[model samples]
Target chain A: MTTSSTLRPGVGDRSVTDPGPPAPRPRGDGAAALAFLTPSIITFLVFVLAPTVGVLVLSFYNWNLLSDGTFVGLDNFDRLIHDGRLLGVYGSTTYMALAILAVNVVLGLLLAVLLETRMPRWLRGFFRLSYLFPFVVSASAVALIWRFLLNKDLGLVNYLLGLVHVDRIDWLGSSAFAPVSVIIVNSWKTIGFSILVYIAGLQSIPDQLREAAIVDGAGAWTRFWRITFPLLSPTIFFLVVINTINSFQIFAEPRVLTQGGPGDSSRTIVEYLYDRAFGDFDLGYASAIGITFALILVVLTAIQFWFSRRWTFY
Target chain B: MSTATTSMSPRLGRLAARVLTFLVLGIAALAITAPFLWIFRGALSGSDAELYRLPPTFDAGTLTVRNFGRVTEQVPYFRFFLNSIIVSTVVTAAQLITCSTAAYAFARLRFRGKGVLFALVIGSLMIPIQVTIVPLFLVMSKLGLTNTLWALILPGIFSAFGIFLLRQHFLGLPRGLEEAAKIDGAGQFRTFARIILPLSGPSIATLGILCFTYWWNDLLLPLVMISDTDRQTLPVGLVLLAGRFSTGSLGTIAAGITMAIVPVLVVFLAAQRYIVQSIASSGLKL
Candidate 1:
């Protein structure tokens, strides 16, 4: 789309109307593009590209800042495989991520459908704004807010539970409950984004399709499932890809709340990786975990992409 | 014409559906905003331990600014606040200048290696900061940038997402713009500066806002890079405040959280309508 315009900026009739060869392009276009691209390319190389290579290489060799440790090929990878805690970490992380994704997709779709129905426009706008308001707040703040609210002794949640003569569930203090608490916290933090995206996706669907379905003696449920849901698949597919990747990188919520505590019940891979690198000062092992986690995300995203072909409708 | 004879059942059903919408959305909205409400409540509840008592009472007399005062007095709240502002602003500005230039090249210019370079740029998206943090940490320490704002700003100035976002918008721009500029004897640089940049204001603004928020809300990187408490960003600072108050009532930490989020809250409230709409439209593009 853009190259054609760049090639024939002023006129496009050179091949059709002119018998002579097309005019030679200006020598400055490539030069300008190079110069324009230089700053970002340099930054990308130094910060992004270089570190990517650094992690891959670092994973293969045991090295610290002060002493250059000897090379140990595949040892880091082997260690990651043998580390029994990894299975638990992966399980909890997947469970948490799937819970988060389910909340985002299902609740997000529900919000979109609700807003699509009869409602005051202002009310819809206000809720949308309020929902996204928490998103702008820093992750640490969200963590802190939830920490306060879920305080088993004095938190508003437990306090309200006490009002109804119900025992307060351990929101963060217990192993079994911490993962669920962070899921709720993290879900609250991120669900607005998907809801907004779904709203946008909902708007893109044509009204006539739903109208035709209804005219053909379809109930509301049938119309939605057969007509609207299939049409919203592209958006769903996009969110699934984006959110799954994001959910895998869950760090701050668990880091700040459970600290992978109550015996690593809420431990995410990123958090475990963080502890290995920073807490243990085990750079090589951390790099290995990093590479492994990155590969998991890449593979999962690729698989999602492959599956999307069957379900995603343009 | 027969629509005026609609049965009461359908109207009642519609009413039930509308009421259900309100019921469901209202409950969801309540659950969503519950944290913010609790934060506000905790921020207001000071030494009055009743706020911490089971079946807490939120009396007007219990509200106090003592915890806010404590937060400011205990930690260098102002320094952290200023550091966040400066770091996020510089990152945002540098990104706007850098990401757009690169995006323009990928969108409008055709070089021999454009496709490969663009793919590499997209490839960077798969490499999250976690994967790069250890090496970046060492690199920063080597360069003596570890406790400075430069460590935060410089590494963040390059973003694959920013480039991707702007490139998509630039590709959709009308071809007549650059053609008109070229017909008037404008060179590539002149056309890009005068016509293309002006026309891509909304895309630039969206990217700028996103980058700023991303930088501002950053915790993990700052936690790794900035060890000196004096140089820490607000997120790090909040965590530190929490650690210090881990033993006592959470009032002071709540106050610190409130302080940290206030600026972001203002920014959000100011541009919320525009941000939400732009986010939606950008979704369609992606």
Candidate 2:
């Protein structure tokens, strides 16, 4: 894959072994490169870079979407410190995110491991694709389907539960149940992705190691706990980081299923941010929340990366 | 006799574990696929009451396609579907063009501040949409593009992830073809368009499908940007439908969801390998 020779200036004309930085032919390739780069650079600046900076600046102002914003330094931050609802939102968001992460990683690993065992080819393929089916569907659509299926009185879930003499549980209405319901629905839609990733990670592990462990008379639990787990730590680390970032951003499930109802029990950060910016038109406060959440995520991701060195194998 | 018993017990235990694993996996797969079948079944039920019936009837004779018609008649389902198609298609195309070109520049050509510029591009990936949606909303409002499809399309057109993925693919390509093309008097753009892109179909398809699935299924952007019924995407439309009609028209709501997900499910099944590989690979490395 080395391209150092091709990158050397005038090397193709002279010889093939020269190594240097790329100098795309002297005939205005820089201009051509600029031409190639301009579209992405412009869009990235306008939509990503500038707006990122703008959100931070807007956090210091009082803009209600209709009028000019007056600079009101520290007021938004002051309010953010005291906002009781914000505290609950963060709590529930973290709770649900962690729950979803646990279900995804653990169940995903279990399913992937089981699938790795000897099975009929069609059955294996069926299980693999079945788990992934929900991942392809949109979150909102999945939520809508689950909303009907999880309804306390008439939904099929309760009906099935009733068949076993279990009482109906208010899945979407009760504050106690809303967050759990959200975790269930969200996990249902997402755990498949984790399973697929784990399967791929399992495939990458050499079979000889597992066979050698079997020859050593190590049982299934022993083999997994000792050999497979450590080898898959890097993959686990990757899924943890990814799932943490995505889970904290949960929006559509709670939005569609509960509408962040029953006293903000299931409200996620993004949904709350949406409510402030669009629903209440409290753009400044929303921007402050956004900035704070972003900062927290940055710190959290850094902490995870820092911790990974101690845990991740590679 | 004791030695035989010890080895036989271990073998029996292993066999039992294998059987349990097979049963557990079978049940889990059934549970996973059940909801999809449930949605499909609900969509076809002839009567709304049938959805609520205890030990729900599985009779095929009781099902019909009328609920699908009812879904469309009740709302602008087709309009939202059309909007989704247009927005996702345009965004995917825009990403392929913008990202691949930029990736080619990063991977093949030399430029000033290339390292810093590329770092900035990668840095954008860490910034979530929630952090920037406020100002983006204002920008859309200022430009009079609020409640329009362009509001969704514009922000989605450039993906830092797409650029990163494409650049990785481009960097792996052998330099012989490009150098020979250059020696034959082909321009950089000509060589890229003629030689590089054709060889990079899998990476391009991977990016395209990823982008399409994302924009097609995205909720928050459409939720914030498009309010007009005529402009809403399918996810937003499905949410609105559920909010308004979910109380009585369970079948109709299911019909709408089925319509929303079926095409994606079909495409996923057809390209399951690519979709799965893309997510797994992207997860591992990115």
Candidate 3:
């Protein structure tokens, strides 16, 4: 997964880039190595590798959980082609992912840049703590909390809006607001991560770059555009890739908060897959969705890496 | 950034920028923190009515500690909590052992097809759980492990990311220490246990916290793997509580959520620097 950015030179060299004195390479440690790797090997083979193959095989079979799957050939994929709801699911998933990427990457960049400005040390810590705390919290728990707070009639959010004389918005109950509500919950929970990563990214940039820009009479906006952002491209690239992948698999938020309700307005692909596999007992069809989603991720990630080359500064 | 700008800007402009920065940061902070605080206060509120009341009250005098009690009474909160603890702790420990040993092999030892083996481990990171989960469920059922906590624990114990992280850490370590240990006639296990492991504490802590936080907060895995209420982890139990009692008990559910998040939040705040450092450096997310 980390190897998605292989197009970037020098990013993958951490393992072999040791500057230490070259001692004799320990050869023929195969027995010990095998002993050490046995647990991981067995588990990985059974859990990860085997199941990956299993998904491809399972896609061709129409089986429920109990009985043996009957060979269905390309029927599942055919069903997938005709599944009109799927386009909507993919739309919602991509919308969620892109919206999250925008919020996380853009707002996070702004917040990170702001935090880097002059402030009390404790204030900086407070900002970081406030933002990053939710990233560590469970998504299910967080979603439940948001669900409670996003309730149209009883939620604190609506209550607070009422205090300002705004009419109550159906945060979760409506097609218009359900997706937005999920986005808010997801973004609120995760934007802190982007802030923290971007802060680290900002810190790694040499002070002299910005200083040199200042000496050239570059204003704040210009300095940021020319000096700060270009240097932060790699960080931007990293966050964009990871956050996109994570958000496309968005399940817990919609599952708990909306359950893809309001006539499937807020449904995502993974949520759709979950409904098919577990809820509807359509394992074969669900596997088709799974394989499709995985392919999209690989293709999308490869596209991101390909695009990153033009802007990602070394 | 501000200090650099001060030399070129007017004092008034700088002050305005500083204030504006804090102003924006203040609103963002409040937006981020308010939900957690509201939930906390709701968890401690005296009644559901108060929790849902407009112009929401956080009046300390009227707050009760009983919603938490209600959460416990309604569900096997402690059982779920204990299950979460057991799963997270065991998974962390297992990952430490498994990842470190495998990482050591990849880092220090030579073997046939090492490159291919390491690539296999690394390559699996790209496979999301959705792809593998259905078959994993099948495997668990075949092994008669579905609906058991083992279903939750077994699949999580091995992480390709963990091995990659610790392998990188091990590669960065000085080989002289291990060479010295070998010259002292210590076996590979003794050298790893005594020297390599001790020096790699920070990396271990980073990986340990990463795994613990991940497993503790994970919902989908437990939701799919453990169907039995007795085996359910906190996230699963909380979701069940939400689905089973959506309309009636927001306060109690808030309490359940607060309990789920607080201990982890406390530990995260305490180890904030290391966790942030690890994520920033390695791009590892829970």
Candidate 4:
């Protein structure tokens, strides 16, 4: 991966595109290279590659840890398309992904810009630490802390609402509110990441460009749109794809907090996959779900990559 | 961007802008830090009543160390702590060793199949462990290693991101030093161990801290592989504790959470620069 990006622009490099002259291999480089690469290669092959292939292959069979798996060609995919539960699963997963992505990208950008310009120099590091502490802690801890905070009664959030004479709400138990609550907690945990990225992006925008725009009498918002936003598009695109990939695998939050409660209102696809695979012992169907999930990621990522070119300056 | 206000606006305007900036930052910081504060107080409070009390505060009158005792007694807290330490340490060590060696080969050596192999390493980044959990579970059961620390540690030992990071670092090193070492009767391994690895401190620290944070907080893999109570990690153990004390013991649960987060927080503070550097650098990479 590193080499391709470096090698792509080269015109006629013999080192690449030609794996020729293999009659009598030089023993010197080959032996040392083998020695260095053996451990990680073997580890990756067995743990990663084999399992990736296993996911694809297992999707074609009907197996439950007991009897030998019977091959059922394309039937799992057929079930995947028609599975009614999956409709809700995919819906919830997409909702969470888009919700979290919006918060991480937009809210994160706003916070980064606010801190970049508005925050006092003496307090910048302290504020960054405050924002990032949540991200540093375990996800389970975050979920459980919010679970406590969102409890029906005797919860800080509800108590705060009671201060204004508003009735207490079941933040995690209600179908209407669970999704919103989960998204908020997940966002709270992860938005720090986007803040950091956007801060870096904001700083990387050379002052001269903005200064030139200001010399032409551009206002704050106008200068941001004309001079800053375009240059920050690459960072924005990266955050969108990365956060989407992350949020698509949202399991621990809902699993710990709500357990897909209120009639699967907060169920994510990975939790659904866990249920089919482990809870139901339907490995074949679960593998099918995994394959479908991976495909969704691939498509989402591909769309992002394709769309990036239109707006990404680089 | 204080320069924005200072460059154009009047002194009073600049003062107002500065106040506004601090106001926004202070509010955001409070929101972000509220959970930590609540958990901290709950961890140190006398009882669940104190924990659930509105206007939660750290009053010397109500504070006690009893919850800390309950945390240890209620669950195998120390055992869980030990398991987390051992797993994270072994995984971190393995990651550093395997990733650096593979990275050195990819960065410097000229050999057949290096390009394809390097691509394979980088490509694995997109393939998350969740996708392969089922087959991986099967692998564990086949080896009869279920509920063992090895089951949790083995699959996590080598990551594509680690290899990619070290390789990037190695590529940035000046070739002169290595060439001089090579001419001065140093072997490839010697040059890598002495010349290359010594100067790659920042990259190594970044990757090491990254791996430590990852293995320390890892939940899904362990949740799937380890079913035994004594074998469970801190995150899983805390989840079990939460389920057990759902109706009571908020103080103890808060203590458990505090215990769980302390090591990670300490790690973050100690290696604060590298951890943030890791995140920032990876942002650029992506």
Q: Which candidate's lDDT is highest?
A: 2
lDDT of 4 by residue, A1-314 (tens): 33223322321232343334323333546645666777788789888998999999999999898976999999999999999999997898789889999999998988888787644565888878778778878789889999889988988999989989989999999998898888999999998878887887887889999999889988777888888899999899989888988899888899998898788899998899998988988999999999888888778877988999888898
Docking class of 4: acceptable
DockQ for the candidate 2 complex?
Answer: 0.46
True interface contacts reproduced, per candidate? 0.64, 0.65, 0.63, 0.52
Interface RMSD (C-alpha) of each candidate? Answer: 5.9, 5.9, 7.0, 6.9
* Backbone clash count, each prediction separately: 0, 0, 0, 1
Clashing pairs in 3: none
**TM-score order of candidates, top first:** 1, 2, 3, 4
Each model's TM-score?
0.92, 0.91, 0.90, 0.90
In the predicted model 4, the residue pairs found to clash are A117-B1
lDDT per residue as tens, model 4, B122-179 = 6777788888899989888888988899899889977898898888889888999987
Can you list each candidate's DockQ? 0.44, 0.46, 0.43, 0.39
Which residue pairs in candidate 1 have backbone atoms (N, alpha carbon, C) closer than 3 angstroms, thus clashing? none
Error of 1 at A147 (Å): 0.9
Off by over 4 Å in 1: A1-24, A162-166, B1-8, B54-56
Q: Which candidate leads in TM-score?
A: 1
1 or 2: which has the higher TM-score? 1
Chain A only, candidate 1, TM-score: 0.89
**Candidate 3 chain A lowest-lDDT run of ten:** A1-10
Segments in model 3 whose C-alpha atoms lie over 4 Å from true places: A1-27, A162-166, B1-9, B284-286
Q: What TM-score does candidate 4 get on C-alpha atoms?
A: 0.90
TM-scores of chain A, one for each prediction: 0.89, 0.90, 0.89, 0.87
Where is the poorest 10-residue window by lDDT in model 1 chain B? B1-10
The 10 consecutive residues of candidate 3 chain B with the worst lDDT sum are B277-286
